[model samples]
Target: YEKSSTILTSNKSYGEWGEIFKDHVIAAALLDRILHHCTTINIKGESYRLKERKKQGIKTGLIRHNSTEILEN
Candidate 1:
């Protein structure tokens, strides 16, 4: 990864990594290297899956929208 470009996606924030990964030290070390030459751009909105479900008349009942939208660069 250090010699080439890589792309990763995570819905959780930095502070939540300790709990997300179940180890603060490992999370910290991992983030340290990843963020060294990283560019972060956050996009917040309703999930397209839900949107399509709604279009198909599937009842989601007001659940929180968690979308994984791809970024093109």
Candidate 2:
């Protein structure tokens, strides 16, 4: 996929990947490869669902968040 773009999304922090996958070595390696050339779009919990609810004039139970942080290597 050279010259093509790849986008990955996640709500959990990279540090927790080991716990989620139950393997620190593998999780770290996977994270390393992803960070090698790809960009990380760190999106918070609000996501699209929360955004649409607000746009439709609905009151969501939880407070909404808005932002995306880019992690580049």
Candidate 3:
């Protein structure tokens, strides 16, 4: 496995992964192995779950507008 390519996916960030694994040493070891030849990609955006709810006609209520003058004041 060490000489082969690999792919991994996780919803949690690296910092949160320590807590998720419940062992800092093991998490570090796991990361070291997985990341050895990995190309890390960070994909960040609004949750797909929320988008589905919106399409289902979920009421999100009014959108707030911010004025420049309010910030200046």
The top-ranked prediction according to lDDT is: 2
Q: Give candidate 3 misplaced runs (Cα > 4 Å).
A: 2-5, 57-73
Residue-level lDDT of model 3, residues 1-73, one tens digit each, is 6676566778787778779989988899987776665577765655556777788999666353433221110
Question: TM per model?
Answer: 0.67, 0.64, 0.63
Clashes of 3: 0
Greater-lDDT candidate between 2 and 3: 2
In the range 1-73, model 2's lDDT, one tens digit per residue, is 4587777766678999999999999999999887787767776557566778889989888764667677777
Q: Name the runs in model 2 displaced over 4 angstroms.
A: 1-3, 51-65
Candidates 1 and 3 compared: the better one by lDDT is 1
TM-score of 1: 0.67
Ranking by TM-score: 1, 2, 3
Better of 1 and 3 by TM-score: 1
Q: Report the lDDT tens digits of candidate 1 across residue range 1-73.
A: 5698787777787788999889999999988887886776665666666888989888887656455444332
Worst 10 residues of 2 by lDDT: 41-50
| Displacement of the residue 31 alpha carbon in candidate 3, Å | 0.4
